[model samples]
Target chain A: MLTYANPNRFMQLARRLTRPVWGLSLACLIIGLYMAFSAPADYQQGMTVRIMFIHVPAAWMSLFVYTFLTVSSIFGLVFRHPLGHVAAKSAALIGAGFTLITLITGALWGKPMWGTWWVWDARLTSVLVLFFIYLGYLFIWKAIEDPLQAGRVSSVLAIVGFVNVPIVKFSVDWWNTLHQPASVSRFDAPALHSDYLWPLLVMALGFQLLFFALWLLRMQTEIFKQKLRVRRLGLVETSNGTAS
Target chain B: MEHVFYIGLSYGVTGVILCLLTANTLSAFFSFRKQIDDEFKPEDSANSP
Candidate 1:
Protein backbone atom coordinates (compact mmCIF):
# COMPACT_ATOMS: atom_id res chain seq x y z
CA MET A 1 0.00 0.00 0.00
CA LEU A 2 2.81 2.36 0.92
CA THR A 3 4.49 1.46 -2.40
CA TYR A 4 1.61 3.21 -4.17
CA ALA A 5 2.48 6.42 -2.27
CA ASN A 6 4.68 7.25 -5.24
CA PRO A 7 2.61 8.98 -7.93
CA ASN A 8 4.28 7.17 -10.84
CA ARG A 9 3.53 3.74 -9.39
CA PHE A 10 -0.01 4.78 -8.50
CA MET A 11 -0.60 6.15 -12.00
CA GLN A 12 0.59 2.88 -13.50
CA LEU A 13 -1.83 0.95 -11.29
CA ALA A 14 -4.70 3.34 -12.06
CA ARG A 15 -4.18 3.07 -15.84
CA ARG A 16 -4.34 -0.69 -15.60
CA LEU A 17 -7.42 -0.86 -13.35
CA THR A 18 -9.67 1.90 -14.78
CA ARG A 19 -10.92 0.04 -17.87
CA PRO A 20 -11.47 -3.32 -16.15
CA VAL A 21 -13.25 -1.69 -13.23
CA TRP A 22 -15.55 0.21 -15.62
CA GLY A 23 -16.37 -2.96 -17.52
CA LEU A 24 -17.20 -4.77 -14.28
CA SER A 25 -19.38 -1.91 -13.12
CA LEU A 26 -21.39 -1.93 -16.36
CA ALA A 27 -21.83 -5.68 -16.14
CA CYS A 28 -23.04 -5.47 -12.53
CA LEU A 29 -25.46 -2.66 -13.32
CA ILE A 30 -27.01 -4.55 -16.22
CA ILE A 31 -27.48 -7.68 -14.12
CA GLY A 32 -28.69 -5.72 -11.15
CA LEU A 33 -31.28 -3.82 -13.21
CA TYR A 34 -32.60 -7.03 -14.62
CA MET A 35 -32.93 -8.52 -11.15
CA ALA A 36 -34.47 -5.39 -9.70
CA PHE A 37 -37.19 -5.22 -12.36
CA SER A 38 -37.93 -8.91 -12.08
CA ALA A 39 -38.28 -8.88 -8.30
CA PRO A 40 -41.81 -9.04 -6.92
CA ALA A 41 -43.38 -5.79 -5.77
CA ASP A 42 -44.24 -5.24 -2.14
CA TYR A 43 -47.81 -5.68 -0.89
CA GLN A 44 -47.54 -2.26 0.78
CA GLN A 45 -45.79 0.00 -1.71
CA GLY A 46 -46.66 -1.88 -4.92
CA MET A 47 -44.63 -0.95 -7.97
CA THR A 48 -43.44 2.20 -6.26
CA VAL A 49 -41.24 -0.06 -4.16
CA ARG A 50 -39.04 -0.41 -7.23
CA ILE A 51 -37.69 2.99 -6.33
CA MET A 52 -35.79 1.27 -3.51
CA PHE A 53 -33.67 -0.50 -6.09
CA ILE A 54 -32.13 2.82 -7.03
CA HIS A 55 -32.68 4.87 -3.90
CA VAL A 56 -31.19 2.55 -1.29
CA PRO A 57 -28.08 1.88 -3.36
CA ALA A 58 -27.48 5.56 -3.97
CA ALA A 59 -27.94 6.24 -0.29
CA TRP A 60 -25.44 3.58 0.58
CA MET A 61 -22.92 4.92 -1.94
CA SER A 62 -23.38 8.47 -0.74
CA LEU A 63 -22.47 7.45 2.77
CA PHE A 64 -19.73 5.12 1.62
CA VAL A 65 -18.05 7.77 -0.56
CA TYR A 66 -18.03 10.32 2.25
CA THR A 67 -16.45 7.78 4.59
CA PHE A 68 -13.86 7.10 1.91
CA LEU A 69 -13.25 10.83 1.54
CA THR A 70 -12.82 11.30 5.28
CA VAL A 71 -10.38 8.40 5.52
CA SER A 72 -8.30 9.75 2.63
CA SER A 73 -8.26 13.16 4.23
CA ILE A 74 -6.96 11.61 7.43
CA PHE A 75 -4.17 9.90 5.53
CA GLY A 76 -3.24 13.17 3.84
CA LEU A 77 -3.19 15.15 7.06
CA VAL A 78 -1.61 12.64 9.42
CA PHE A 79 0.79 10.85 7.09
CA ARG A 80 1.60 13.71 4.71
CA HIS A 81 1.25 11.26 1.85
CA PRO A 82 1.46 12.94 -1.55
CA LEU A 83 -1.50 11.07 -3.05
CA GLY A 84 -3.74 11.49 0.01
CA HIS A 85 -4.94 14.99 -0.87
CA VAL A 86 -5.39 13.95 -4.47
CA ALA A 87 -7.58 11.01 -3.45
CA ALA A 88 -9.78 13.13 -1.20
CA LYS A 89 -10.11 15.92 -3.78
CA SER A 90 -10.86 13.42 -6.53
CA ALA A 91 -13.69 11.80 -4.53
CA ALA A 92 -15.64 14.98 -3.65
CA LEU A 93 -17.66 15.37 -6.88
CA ILE A 94 -18.42 11.68 -7.13
CA GLY A 95 -19.55 11.63 -3.51
CA ALA A 96 -21.68 14.71 -4.05
CA GLY A 97 -23.26 13.19 -7.16
CA PHE A 98 -24.18 10.07 -5.20
CA THR A 99 -25.61 12.24 -2.42
CA LEU A 100 -27.70 14.11 -4.99
CA ILE A 101 -29.04 10.86 -6.39
CA THR A 102 -29.89 9.71 -2.88
CA LEU A 103 -31.87 12.90 -2.16
CA ILE A 104 -33.76 13.02 -5.45
CA THR A 105 -34.63 9.36 -5.45
CA GLY A 106 -35.53 9.48 -1.77
CA ALA A 107 -37.97 12.27 -2.59
CA LEU A 108 -39.50 10.29 -5.45
CA TRP A 109 -39.96 7.30 -3.13
CA GLY A 110 -41.30 9.50 -0.36
CA LYS A 111 -44.00 11.16 -2.46
CA PRO A 112 -45.82 7.93 -3.17
CA MET A 113 -45.17 6.21 0.17
CA TRP A 114 -45.08 8.96 2.76
CA GLY A 115 -47.61 11.11 0.82
CA THR A 116 -45.09 13.95 0.86
CA TRP A 117 -41.97 14.88 -1.11
CA TRP A 118 -39.84 15.49 1.98
CA VAL A 119 -39.87 16.13 5.72
CA TRP A 120 -37.56 17.66 8.30
CA ASP A 121 -36.96 14.25 9.80
CA ALA A 122 -33.66 13.45 11.48
CA ARG A 123 -32.34 11.00 8.86
CA LEU A 124 -33.32 13.10 5.89
CA THR A 125 -32.14 16.35 7.42
CA SER A 126 -28.79 14.95 8.53
CA VAL A 127 -28.20 13.53 5.05
CA LEU A 128 -28.99 16.95 3.65
CA VAL A 129 -26.44 18.44 6.02
CA LEU A 130 -23.95 15.83 4.84
CA PHE A 131 -24.51 16.94 1.26
CA PHE A 132 -23.88 20.54 2.24
CA ILE A 133 -20.67 19.51 3.96
CA TYR A 134 -19.56 17.86 0.72
CA LEU A 135 -20.30 21.06 -1.20
CA GLY A 136 -18.41 23.10 1.38
CA TYR A 137 -15.41 20.81 1.12
CA LEU A 138 -15.37 21.24 -2.64
CA PHE A 139 -15.79 24.99 -2.29
CA ILE A 140 -12.82 25.19 0.06
CA TRP A 141 -10.64 23.51 -2.55
CA LYS A 142 -11.64 26.07 -5.17
CA ALA A 143 -11.54 29.04 -2.78
CA ILE A 144 -8.00 28.45 -1.52
CA GLU A 145 -5.12 29.45 -3.82
CA ASP A 146 -2.31 27.27 -2.53
CA PRO A 147 -2.61 23.48 -2.91
CA LEU A 148 -1.04 22.66 0.46
CA GLN A 149 -3.23 25.16 2.31
CA ALA A 150 -6.36 24.03 0.47
CA GLY A 151 -5.57 20.41 1.30
CA ARG A 152 -5.05 21.17 4.99
CA VAL A 153 -8.18 23.31 5.34
CA SER A 154 -10.47 20.97 3.41
CA SER A 155 -9.06 17.96 5.24
CA VAL A 156 -9.98 19.56 8.54
CA LEU A 157 -13.50 20.09 7.22
CA ALA A 158 -13.72 16.50 6.00
CA ILE A 159 -12.67 15.19 9.40
CA VAL A 160 -15.07 17.40 11.31
CA GLY A 161 -17.95 16.87 8.89
CA PHE A 162 -17.63 13.08 9.21
CA VAL A 163 -19.44 13.31 12.54
CA ASN A 164 -22.62 13.78 10.51
CA VAL A 165 -22.20 10.41 8.76
CA PRO A 166 -22.92 8.22 11.78
CA ILE A 167 -25.64 10.61 12.86
CA VAL A 168 -27.26 10.19 9.45
CA LYS A 169 -27.02 6.42 9.73
CA PHE A 170 -28.50 6.08 13.20
CA SER A 171 -30.95 8.95 12.90
CA VAL A 172 -33.98 6.80 12.18
CA ASP A 173 -33.31 4.70 15.25
CA TRP A 174 -32.41 7.69 17.38
CA TRP A 175 -35.55 9.59 16.48
CA ASN A 176 -39.16 8.73 15.67
CA THR A 177 -38.80 9.48 11.99
CA LEU A 178 -41.11 8.60 9.13
CA HIS A 179 -38.28 6.60 7.62
CA GLN A 180 -37.97 3.00 8.73
CA PRO A 181 -34.98 1.80 10.70
CA ALA A 182 -32.27 -0.32 9.10
CA SER A 183 -33.73 -3.06 6.94
CA VAL A 184 -30.71 -4.64 5.29
CA SER A 185 -27.85 -3.48 7.51
CA ARG A 186 -29.05 -4.37 10.99
CA PHE A 187 -27.04 -6.61 13.28
CA ASP A 188 -29.88 -9.07 13.30
CA ALA A 189 -31.21 -10.71 10.17
CA PRO A 190 -32.32 -8.25 7.52
CA ALA A 191 -35.96 -7.17 7.61
CA LEU A 192 -36.13 -7.10 3.79
CA HIS A 193 -37.41 -10.19 2.03
CA SER A 194 -34.94 -12.28 0.07
CA ASP A 195 -36.55 -11.12 -3.15
CA TYR A 196 -35.88 -7.44 -2.48
CA LEU A 197 -32.65 -8.13 -0.61
CA TRP A 198 -30.86 -9.89 -3.44
CA PRO A 199 -31.53 -7.24 -6.08
CA LEU A 200 -30.71 -4.45 -3.65
CA LEU A 201 -27.38 -6.06 -2.82
CA VAL A 202 -26.53 -6.43 -6.51
CA MET A 203 -27.36 -2.79 -7.17
CA ALA A 204 -25.23 -1.75 -4.21
CA LEU A 205 -22.31 -3.74 -5.62
CA GLY A 206 -22.77 -2.07 -8.99
CA PHE A 207 -22.78 1.36 -7.35
CA GLN A 208 -19.58 0.52 -5.44
CA LEU A 209 -17.83 -0.64 -8.59
CA LEU A 210 -18.87 2.49 -10.45
CA PHE A 211 -17.53 4.65 -7.63
CA PHE A 212 -14.13 2.94 -7.79
CA ALA A 213 -13.98 3.33 -11.59
CA LEU A 214 -14.76 7.05 -11.35
CA TRP A 215 -12.42 7.60 -8.39
CA LEU A 216 -9.42 6.24 -10.28
CA LEU A 217 -10.21 8.36 -13.35
CA ARG A 218 -10.56 11.50 -11.27
CA MET A 219 -7.36 10.79 -9.32
CA GLN A 220 -5.45 10.33 -12.57
CA THR A 221 -6.75 13.69 -13.77
CA GLU A 222 -5.64 15.34 -10.53
CA ILE A 223 -2.15 13.87 -10.90
CA PHE A 224 -1.89 15.21 -14.41
CA LYS A 225 -3.08 18.62 -13.25
CA GLN A 226 -0.36 18.60 -10.60
CA LYS A 227 2.24 17.59 -13.15
CA LEU A 228 1.15 20.34 -15.53
CA ARG A 229 1.33 22.91 -12.74
CA VAL A 230 4.88 21.90 -11.84
CA ARG A 231 5.89 21.90 -15.51
CA ARG A 232 4.48 25.39 -16.00
CA LEU A 233 6.35 26.62 -12.96
CA GLY A 234 9.59 25.14 -14.23
CA LEU A 235 9.06 26.75 -17.63
CA VAL A 236 8.50 30.17 -16.05
CA GLU A 237 11.60 29.80 -13.86
CA THR A 238 13.75 28.80 -16.88
CA SER A 239 12.58 31.81 -18.93
CA ASN A 240 13.20 34.13 -15.96
CA GLY A 241 16.72 32.73 -15.59
CA THR A 242 17.46 33.35 -19.28
CA ALA A 243 16.09 36.90 -18.97
CA SER A 244 18.27 37.55 -15.88
CA MET B 1 -50.19 0.60 -11.77
CA GLU B 2 -51.00 4.07 -10.42
CA HIS B 3 -47.50 4.45 -8.94
CA VAL B 4 -45.73 3.40 -12.14
CA PHE B 5 -45.00 7.01 -12.91
CA TYR B 6 -43.10 7.49 -9.66
CA ILE B 7 -40.96 4.43 -10.19
CA GLY B 8 -40.26 5.33 -13.80
CA LEU B 9 -39.33 8.88 -12.93
CA SER B 10 -36.96 7.79 -10.19
CA TYR B 11 -35.06 5.37 -12.40
CA GLY B 12 -35.10 7.80 -15.33
CA VAL B 13 -33.67 10.67 -13.32
CA THR B 14 -31.02 8.45 -11.75
CA GLY B 15 -29.90 7.15 -15.14
CA VAL B 16 -29.61 10.66 -16.55
CA ILE B 17 -27.69 11.98 -13.55
CA LEU B 18 -25.26 9.07 -13.45
CA CYS B 19 -24.68 9.38 -17.20
CA LEU B 20 -23.94 13.10 -16.87
CA LEU B 21 -21.55 12.55 -13.98
CA THR B 22 -19.73 9.82 -15.84
CA ALA B 23 -19.47 12.02 -18.92
CA ASN B 24 -18.12 14.95 -16.94
CA THR B 25 -15.50 12.81 -15.16
CA LEU B 26 -14.34 11.22 -18.43
CA SER B 27 -14.08 14.56 -20.18
CA ALA B 28 -12.06 16.03 -17.32
CA PHE B 29 -9.73 13.01 -17.30
CA PHE B 30 -9.07 13.18 -21.04
CA SER B 31 -8.73 16.96 -21.04
CA PHE B 32 -6.06 16.91 -18.35
CA ARG B 33 -4.23 14.00 -19.96
CA LYS B 34 -4.19 15.81 -23.28
CA GLN B 35 -2.84 18.97 -21.71
CA ILE B 36 -0.03 17.10 -19.99
CA ASP B 37 0.80 15.18 -23.16
CA ASP B 38 0.93 18.36 -25.19
CA GLU B 39 3.09 20.02 -22.59
CA PHE B 40 5.69 17.28 -22.83
CA LYS B 41 5.40 16.45 -26.57
CA PRO B 42 7.21 19.60 -27.75
CA GLU B 43 10.33 18.79 -25.73
CA ASP B 44 10.27 15.22 -27.02
CA SER B 45 9.86 16.34 -30.64
CA ALA B 46 12.59 18.92 -30.31
CA ASN B 47 15.03 16.25 -29.14
CA SER B 48 14.08 13.63 -31.77
CA PRO B 49 14.69 13.14 -35.56
Candidate 2:
Protein backbone atom coordinates (compact mmCIF):
# COMPACT_ATOMS: atom_id res chain seq x y z
CA MET A 1 0.00 0.00 0.00
CA LEU A 2 2.72 2.46 1.03
CA THR A 3 4.73 1.35 -1.96
CA TYR A 4 2.21 3.03 -4.26
CA ALA A 5 1.91 6.24 -2.25
CA ASN A 6 4.01 8.23 -4.65
CA PRO A 7 1.58 9.69 -7.17
CA ASN A 8 3.70 8.61 -10.15
CA ARG A 9 3.98 5.04 -8.95
CA PHE A 10 0.24 4.91 -8.26
CA MET A 11 -0.51 6.20 -11.74
CA GLN A 12 1.81 3.59 -13.29
CA LEU A 13 -0.01 0.72 -11.61
CA ALA A 14 -3.50 2.12 -12.04
CA ARG A 15 -2.97 2.57 -15.75
CA ARG A 16 -1.69 -0.95 -16.17
CA LEU A 17 -4.45 -2.52 -14.09
CA THR A 18 -7.57 -0.70 -15.36
CA ARG A 19 -8.14 -2.81 -18.47
CA PRO A 20 -7.92 -6.17 -16.73
CA VAL A 21 -9.95 -4.93 -13.79
CA TRP A 22 -12.72 -3.76 -16.09
CA GLY A 23 -12.62 -6.96 -18.11
CA LEU A 24 -12.98 -9.16 -15.08
CA SER A 25 -15.73 -6.99 -13.65
CA LEU A 26 -17.77 -7.19 -16.83
CA ALA A 27 -17.28 -10.92 -17.17
CA CYS A 28 -18.42 -11.60 -13.64
CA LEU A 29 -21.40 -9.30 -14.12
CA ILE A 30 -22.51 -11.09 -17.28
CA ILE A 31 -22.24 -14.53 -15.75
CA GLY A 32 -23.73 -13.44 -12.45
CA LEU A 33 -26.80 -11.87 -14.04
CA TYR A 34 -27.24 -14.98 -16.17
CA MET A 35 -27.40 -17.10 -13.08
CA ALA A 36 -29.54 -14.64 -11.15
CA PHE A 37 -32.16 -14.32 -13.80
CA SER A 38 -32.21 -18.04 -14.47
CA ALA A 39 -32.57 -19.12 -10.82
CA PRO A 40 -36.00 -20.24 -9.60
CA ALA A 41 -38.29 -18.18 -7.39
CA ASP A 42 -38.11 -18.46 -3.65
CA TYR A 43 -40.79 -20.74 -2.22
CA GLN A 44 -41.63 -17.83 0.05
CA GLN A 45 -41.02 -14.40 -1.49
CA GLY A 46 -41.41 -15.25 -5.19
CA MET A 47 -40.36 -12.62 -7.72
CA THR A 48 -39.74 -9.84 -5.19
CA VAL A 49 -36.76 -11.55 -3.64
CA ARG A 50 -34.92 -11.10 -6.92
CA ILE A 51 -34.10 -7.58 -5.81
CA MET A 52 -31.70 -9.23 -3.44
CA PHE A 53 -29.60 -9.91 -6.49
CA ILE A 54 -28.78 -6.22 -6.47
CA HIS A 55 -29.62 -5.16 -2.92
CA VAL A 56 -27.35 -7.60 -1.17
CA PRO A 57 -24.34 -6.68 -3.24
CA ALA A 58 -24.96 -2.96 -2.91
CA ALA A 59 -25.36 -3.29 0.85
CA TRP A 60 -22.13 -5.23 1.07
CA MET A 61 -20.28 -2.61 -0.94
CA SER A 62 -21.64 0.26 1.16
CA LEU A 63 -20.31 -1.22 4.38
CA PHE A 64 -17.14 -2.55 2.81
CA VAL A 65 -16.22 0.82 1.33
CA TYR A 66 -16.74 2.57 4.66
CA THR A 67 -14.50 0.05 6.35
CA PHE A 68 -11.83 0.68 3.74
CA LEU A 69 -12.16 4.42 4.26
CA THR A 70 -11.71 4.14 8.01
CA VAL A 71 -8.64 1.95 7.72
CA SER A 72 -7.12 4.24 5.11
CA SER A 73 -7.80 7.30 7.25
CA ILE A 74 -6.09 5.67 10.21
CA PHE A 75 -3.06 4.91 8.09
CA GLY A 76 -2.98 8.48 6.83
CA LEU A 77 -3.08 9.89 10.35
CA VAL A 78 -0.44 7.56 11.75
CA PHE A 79 2.02 7.43 8.87
CA ARG A 80 1.36 10.93 7.54
CA HIS A 81 0.94 9.50 4.06
CA PRO A 82 -0.76 12.08 1.82
CA LEU A 83 -2.03 9.38 -0.52
CA GLY A 84 -3.82 7.80 2.41
CA HIS A 85 -6.00 10.86 2.80
CA VAL A 86 -6.59 10.94 -0.94
CA ALA A 87 -7.61 7.31 -0.84
CA ALA A 88 -9.92 7.94 2.10
CA LYS A 89 -11.62 10.90 0.44
CA SER A 90 -11.99 9.11 -2.87
CA ALA A 91 -13.41 6.11 -1.08
CA ALA A 92 -15.92 8.22 0.84
CA LEU A 93 -17.58 9.45 -2.35
CA ILE A 94 -17.80 5.94 -3.82
CA GLY A 95 -19.04 4.59 -0.50
CA ALA A 96 -21.83 7.13 -0.51
CA GLY A 97 -22.88 5.98 -3.99
CA PHE A 98 -23.08 2.39 -2.80
CA THR A 99 -24.97 3.45 0.33
CA LEU A 100 -27.53 5.26 -1.76
CA ILE A 101 -27.97 2.19 -3.94
CA THR A 102 -28.42 0.04 -0.85
CA LEU A 103 -31.11 2.24 0.63
CA ILE A 104 -33.02 2.67 -2.61
CA THR A 105 -32.90 -0.98 -3.60
CA GLY A 106 -33.75 -2.07 -0.10
CA ALA A 107 -36.79 0.14 -0.26
CA LEU A 108 -37.76 -1.46 -3.56
CA TRP A 109 -37.37 -4.90 -2.05
CA GLY A 110 -39.17 -3.96 1.14
CA LYS A 111 -42.30 -2.66 -0.52
CA PRO A 112 -43.16 -6.12 -1.82
CA MET A 113 -41.54 -8.22 0.91
CA TRP A 114 -42.52 -6.33 4.04
CA GLY A 115 -45.52 -4.48 2.57
CA THR A 116 -43.89 -1.17 3.43
CA TRP A 117 -41.84 1.31 1.45
CA TRP A 118 -39.85 2.37 4.49
CA VAL A 119 -39.29 1.23 8.04
CA TRP A 120 -37.64 2.54 11.18
CA ASP A 121 -36.60 -0.95 12.17
CA ALA A 122 -33.17 -1.63 13.65
CA ARG A 123 -31.40 -2.92 10.54
CA LEU A 124 -32.84 -0.25 8.30
CA THR A 125 -32.23 2.51 10.82
CA SER A 126 -28.63 1.50 11.37
CA VAL A 127 -28.05 1.60 7.63
CA LEU A 128 -29.67 5.02 7.46
CA VAL A 129 -27.27 6.27 10.13
CA LEU A 130 -24.39 4.71 8.27
CA PHE A 131 -25.43 6.65 5.18
CA PHE A 132 -25.43 9.83 7.23
CA ILE A 133 -21.94 9.07 8.46
CA TYR A 134 -20.74 8.82 4.90
CA LEU A 135 -22.33 12.17 4.12
CA GLY A 136 -20.93 13.68 7.30
CA TYR A 137 -17.45 12.59 6.36
CA LEU A 138 -17.84 14.04 2.86
CA PHE A 139 -19.32 17.26 4.27
CA ILE A 140 -16.38 17.63 6.62
CA TRP A 141 -14.05 17.38 3.66
CA LYS A 142 -15.87 20.15 1.81
CA ALA A 143 -16.58 22.34 4.85
CA ILE A 144 -12.92 22.73 5.64
CA GLU A 145 -10.30 24.20 3.30
CA ASP A 146 -7.34 22.72 5.11
CA PRO A 147 -6.84 19.13 4.01
CA LEU A 148 -4.61 18.33 6.96
CA GLN A 149 -7.16 19.66 9.42
CA ALA A 150 -9.96 17.94 7.52
CA GLY A 151 -7.97 14.73 7.56
CA ARG A 152 -7.58 14.81 11.34
CA VAL A 153 -11.21 15.71 11.98
CA SER A 154 -12.68 13.27 9.49
CA SER A 155 -10.31 10.55 10.60
CA VAL A 156 -11.91 10.85 14.01
CA LEU A 157 -15.36 10.69 12.45
CA ALA A 158 -14.34 7.67 10.37
CA ILE A 159 -13.15 5.80 13.46
CA VAL A 160 -16.24 6.70 15.45
CA GLY A 161 -18.56 5.94 12.56
CA PHE A 162 -17.30 2.35 12.60
CA VAL A 163 -19.51 1.53 15.58
CA ASN A 164 -22.61 1.65 13.39
CA VAL A 165 -21.31 -1.24 11.31
CA PRO A 166 -21.70 -3.75 14.12
CA ILE A 167 -25.10 -2.32 14.89
CA VAL A 168 -26.01 -2.81 11.25
CA LYS A 169 -24.77 -6.37 11.56
CA PHE A 170 -26.63 -7.25 14.79
CA SER A 171 -29.77 -5.21 14.49
CA VAL A 172 -31.84 -8.16 13.30
CA ASP A 173 -30.87 -10.24 16.31
CA TRP A 174 -31.39 -7.39 18.73
CA TRP A 175 -34.80 -6.27 17.53
CA ASN A 176 -38.03 -7.55 16.05
CA THR A 177 -37.62 -5.97 12.67
CA LEU A 178 -39.36 -6.42 9.34
CA HIS A 179 -35.95 -6.80 7.78
CA GLN A 180 -34.92 -10.42 7.55
CA PRO A 181 -32.19 -11.86 9.71
CA ALA A 182 -28.84 -12.67 8.12
CA SER A 183 -29.40 -15.43 5.60
CA VAL A 184 -25.97 -15.34 3.92
CA SER A 185 -24.13 -14.17 7.02
CA ARG A 186 -24.61 -16.82 9.72
CA PHE A 187 -21.69 -19.25 9.89
CA ASP A 188 -23.90 -22.25 10.62
CA ALA A 189 -25.76 -22.93 7.38
CA PRO A 190 -26.66 -20.54 4.67
CA ALA A 191 -30.44 -20.49 4.48
CA LEU A 192 -30.02 -20.09 0.73
CA HIS A 193 -29.26 -23.19 -1.35
CA SER A 194 -26.82 -23.46 -4.26
CA ASP A 195 -29.42 -22.27 -6.76
CA TYR A 196 -29.41 -18.83 -5.10
CA LEU A 197 -26.06 -18.70 -3.34
CA TRP A 198 -23.72 -18.80 -6.30
CA PRO A 199 -25.28 -15.88 -8.14
CA LEU A 200 -25.28 -13.79 -4.99
CA LEU A 201 -21.61 -14.52 -4.48
CA VAL A 202 -20.80 -13.59 -8.04
CA MET A 203 -22.71 -10.34 -7.83
CA ALA A 204 -21.00 -9.56 -4.55
CA LEU A 205 -17.57 -10.09 -6.05
CA GLY A 206 -18.45 -7.97 -9.09
CA PHE A 207 -19.61 -5.08 -6.93
CA GLN A 208 -16.43 -5.30 -4.86
CA LEU A 209 -14.20 -5.12 -7.92
CA LEU A 210 -16.23 -2.27 -9.36
CA PHE A 211 -15.71 -0.36 -6.13
CA PHE A 212 -11.96 -0.88 -6.32
CA ALA A 213 -11.73 0.29 -9.90
CA LEU A 214 -13.71 3.41 -9.08
CA TRP A 215 -11.69 4.04 -5.94
CA LEU A 216 -8.46 3.90 -7.87
CA LEU A 217 -9.89 6.18 -10.52
CA ARG A 218 -11.00 8.74 -7.93
CA MET A 219 -7.70 8.62 -6.05
CA GLN A 220 -5.75 9.09 -9.27
CA THR A 221 -7.86 12.11 -10.18
CA GLU A 222 -7.34 13.72 -6.78
CA ILE A 223 -3.59 13.15 -6.95
CA PHE A 224 -3.38 14.69 -10.39
CA LYS A 225 -5.42 17.73 -9.31
CA GLN A 226 -3.10 18.22 -6.36
CA LYS A 227 -0.15 18.26 -8.69
CA LEU A 228 -1.89 20.77 -10.94
CA ARG A 229 -2.65 22.99 -7.97
CA VAL A 230 0.94 22.87 -6.82
CA ARG A 231 2.22 23.84 -10.22
CA ARG A 232 -0.16 26.78 -10.43
CA LEU A 233 0.82 27.96 -6.98
CA GLY A 234 4.50 27.67 -7.84
CA LEU A 235 3.94 29.83 -10.89
CA VAL A 236 2.23 32.46 -8.78
CA GLU A 237 5.06 32.44 -6.25
CA THR A 238 7.74 32.69 -8.93
CA SER A 239 5.91 35.61 -10.54
CA ASN A 240 5.65 37.38 -7.22
CA GLY A 241 9.31 36.81 -6.51
CA THR A 242 10.35 38.24 -9.90
CA ALA A 243 8.09 41.27 -9.48
CA SER A 244 9.68 42.09 -6.16
CA MET B 1 -40.90 -11.61 -17.88
CA GLU B 2 -41.06 -9.30 -14.91
CA HIS B 3 -38.11 -11.01 -13.30
CA VAL B 4 -36.19 -10.72 -16.53
CA PHE B 5 -36.97 -7.01 -16.69
CA TYR B 6 -35.75 -6.41 -13.14
CA ILE B 7 -32.60 -8.38 -13.72
CA GLY B 8 -31.87 -6.53 -16.94
CA LEU B 9 -32.50 -3.20 -15.21
CA SER B 10 -29.97 -3.96 -12.54
CA TYR B 11 -27.32 -4.94 -15.03
CA GLY B 12 -28.11 -1.96 -17.23
CA VAL B 13 -27.65 0.55 -14.46
CA THR B 14 -24.37 -1.00 -13.44
CA GLY B 15 -23.09 -1.01 -16.97
CA VAL B 16 -23.97 2.61 -17.68
CA ILE B 17 -22.35 3.85 -14.51
CA LEU B 18 -19.19 1.86 -15.10
CA CYS B 19 -18.93 3.00 -18.70
CA LEU B 20 -19.16 6.65 -17.75
CA LEU B 21 -16.65 6.18 -14.98
CA THR B 22 -14.21 4.47 -17.31
CA ALA B 23 -14.41 7.29 -19.80
CA ASN B 24 -13.85 9.83 -17.05
CA THR B 25 -10.79 7.89 -15.90
CA LEU B 26 -9.21 7.59 -19.35
CA SER B 27 -9.48 11.32 -20.05
CA ALA B 28 -7.95 12.16 -16.70
CA PHE B 29 -5.14 9.68 -17.19
CA PHE B 30 -4.18 11.02 -20.62
CA SER B 31 -4.38 14.65 -19.54
CA PHE B 32 -2.30 14.12 -16.45
CA ARG B 33 0.38 12.27 -18.33
CA LYS B 34 0.42 15.12 -20.84
CA GLN B 35 0.78 17.65 -18.03
CA ILE B 36 3.73 15.78 -16.59
CA ASP B 37 5.36 15.73 -20.00
CA ASP B 38 4.64 19.41 -20.64
CA GLU B 39 6.13 20.43 -17.33
CA PHE B 40 9.37 18.71 -18.18
CA LYS B 41 9.43 19.13 -21.99
CA PRO B 42 11.42 22.38 -22.24
CA GLU B 43 14.63 20.95 -20.81
CA ASP B 44 14.91 18.06 -23.27
CA SER B 45 16.61 20.01 -26.08
CA ALA B 46 20.41 20.47 -26.30
CA ASN B 47 21.08 23.53 -28.51
CA SER B 48 21.37 26.35 -25.97
CA PRO B 49 24.66 27.71 -24.53
Best candidate (score: TM-score): 1
Per-residue lDDT of model 2, residues A170-211, tens digit only:
899999978888799779999889899999999999888877
TM-score for candidate 1, please give it.
0.96
Docking class of 2: acceptable
The prediction achieving the highest DockQ against the true structure is: 1
Per-model chain B TM-scores are: 0.78, 0.72
User: Reference contacts recovered by each candidate, as fractions?
Assistant: 0.94, 0.14
Flag regions of model 2 displaced more than 4 Å. A1-5, B1-49
> Which pairs of residues collide in model 1?
none
lDDT of 1: 0.92
**TM-score for all predictions?**
0.96, 0.87
Q: Write the per-residue lDDT of candidate 2 for residues B1-49, one digit (tens) a residue.
A: 5555544555566556557656766677678768867874674554352
Against the true structure, what is model 2's DockQ? 0.31
B46, model 2: CA deviation in Å?
9.1
